[model samples]
Target: MQEAIIRGAEFDRLDMDRVPQFLTRLVTRLCVDEARHNAIVKKMASHPRLIPHSADDLVDVVCDNAEAQWLAARLEAFSPKDRKLVLMLTSGFTRKEIAEELGTTPQGTHSALYRIRKKMVERYG
Candidate 1:
């Protein structure tokens, strides 16, 4: 999580043209660690009688809830553009910044964000 925040800050500082390459470099460095951690977790999960109370179990329960499942389905139903707009907006990008990254105007980014927020409220309220 700290690393992701640092990466986001780095991304915010970079020129648009360099962002992709920076992301590629960061992902290359992180992927190996992520894979190793996942493998360890997989092995741990396979063990008999692990921790009685785990965050994974909580996540599983939440995921099984009808409301949570419905929300997940609604999120899944979003178009790629909608998803991208929401993701960028949610990740602390200003309208201008998101517009620059997406090759659109600030007004367009604002419009997209408004629609995305409305859809989220309609789905989750």
Candidate 2:
């Protein structure tokens, strides 16, 4: 409910009469997406990992070494909470999902993201 209104603030205008329906749809969509995300996460957790035997299968190793490690070093320099937030965002958590996980409002989540991006640009760029 609160999340919907926070998200709604992004729109310049909405049909005054349909506002309830609009918020209902927005919440419903978020619920559906969250359910799907949970199911996918569960499925992946139960899936087996395949061992890399060929060069192609090892591309991830090369890529991770080249970029992931570099970004990881910078991410490590953040405060524990900020580092966790960055990891959550990278792992496909929605703003609302992150807010729920962090026990914060969506507006706070958005503000944190903005601050994180600014710090990254200013300190790392």
lDDT of each: 0.66, 0.71
What tens digits encode model 1's per-residue C-alpha lDDT throughout 1-125?
A: 67875777777565778768877887887999999999999999988778465322444334324333343446677888766665665454556677889999977876775676578798767
- lDDT digits (tens) for residues 12-105 of candidate 2: 7856788888768888999999999999888877777743333322454354234434454688678989878766765656667888999998
Error of 1 at 85 (Å): 1.4
Candidate with the greatest TM-score versus the true structure: 2
CA RMSD of each candidate after superposition: 22.1, 18.9
The C-alpha stretches of model 2 lying farther than 4 A from their native spots are: 1-73
Clashing residue pairs in candidate 1 are none
Model 2, residue 115: distance off in Å is 0.6
State the number of backbone clashes in model 1.
Answer: 0
